[model samples]
Target: MTATGTTLVIGATGTTGSRTAARLMAGGHRVKAASRRATSIPGAEPVLFDWYDPATHAAALDGVDRVYLIPPVGESDPAVVMLPFLHRARTAGVQRAVLLSSSAIPEGGPAVGTVHQALPDLFQQWAVLRPSWFMQNFTDTHAHALSIREDGIIWTATDSGRVGFVDAEDIAAVAVHALTDEHAPNTDLVLTGPEALSYDDVATILTEVTGRPVVHRKLSYEQLRDRLTALVPVEFAAILAGLDRAIAEGAEDRLTDTVQRLIGRPARTLRALCEREMR
Candidate 1:
């Protein structure tokens, strides 16, 4: 927002948050980059912020009029901590808030969904980003990335289900637009890439681009859940596994023009991501 004051970017070092903060700063906007370690980001004011800690909230909220929210990771339910800080944020003069949510979760569905539902009551200018699964999951230090590096395999419970795997950078562009635009969407925006693709299709593209032997190894819901329990909390593991199951049921099999409509550009493709990250 050109006329607005500083915008506090919660989870500033995280996936979409970091990119959003950078874009804002590049556009000559003030930003308070909120993170757990208060990591330094170029063109941003770093601030120590944690959802579990209330003492860190006040300092981060100082002199900020808007916020970009990235909910706590690995917690099946984040609304408990998020809602309180949001309430405090409203009192501290935050007029607009942009939330990062998932396509699988709707307003009042689960997890950040609760926060999505409460936005109207808290901030007059508020928008929720419900993006499809991120393409970075297959490239970054995520479990899929690690497995791809070690075993040359991509594991998932979604069998034959297609998803509009969006790029985090694209998601951030939409986020920046939502945060800085004159009018907040005041609604949930379901973002996706240009096309829908399945895990098998992803592996095929990876192999073609990177010249690596990557394959999609499909698993049952219970199997994936048990496997993920060793990596994350049991409850979160179940939730992640359940999302994969939903994908199998064609829940994520679609595409949207939100990215194009908001940013005036076609969403990036998984093949492009594979070429950049893998090759």
Candidate 2:
């Protein structure tokens, strides 16, 4: 028998997925936090669901009627890994899917674009949330924090282009509304913060907030990739730098009202995000 009320939240321990699960739980919805390990988080039961292992797939899909699909991280071809899971979800009689996709990549780009192509035929209802670069890059994650503590510098290939730097919390809120409501807009939604700001703007804000000197160092794509290789794999670093090049070329410079449209409120501003996030 299909699980009537539970929503399977893939990558539920991640930045966006964790927030999505919490919001779902707060709304009194049953949530299964699906991850590679049976790790526990607040507001949800843990379930083992690895993208690499199909053996763990069925148990995760079992009884769940809806899913929040997070693409495998650092994979060159995430769609290859996720398509089978989507097929399984369809076979399991899952009704709706909310896909967490990238704003940098277009609908048919190299990343989750394949899922964008396949999901329409597989699921009865779907919504894709394409959000701009997260403001949390400077606050929560290891790399950004390490940058702050050690060098007091932020580096990127964004050049002078401004991003609307949406908050992950806002993205999660939209995902919760999309997954729970039957009337969710059945199309790709590009979500961004209310104002557009450059890396310089971000660094200035961080400096002001933390009472320290924080600088934005503009690096060439190649230089950025080389530097990131010291922290992450060279291949992943290349991909990230390429996306930053896309930003530098003005791909992610525009702002959208998707967050406000979906959540009925203005998206969080970068300064506001920093005020709360920076310590």
Candidate 1 lDDT, 168-234, residue by residue in tens: 9999999989888999999999999998999999898888988878999999999999999999999
Per-residue lDDT of 1-279 in model 2, one digit per residue for the tens? Answer: 112388999999899999999989988889999998878987788999899999999989888888998999878789888998899889997888999988887778877887887777787788888989888888887576679768999888889988889899999999988898856557888888888888898888889888999998899999999988887778878988998898888888889888887778989987888788776
Number of backbone-clashing residue pairs for each candidate, in the order shown: 1, 1
Badly placed stretches (over 4 Å) of model 1 are none
TM-score (C-alpha) between model 1 and the true structure:
0.98
> What's the distance in Å from true for residue 184, model 2?
3.2
Cα lDDT of candidate 1 equals 0.93
Choose the strongest candidate by TM-score.
Answer: 1
C-alpha-based local distance difference test score of model 2: 0.86
Candidate number achieving the greatest lDDT relative to the actual structure? 1
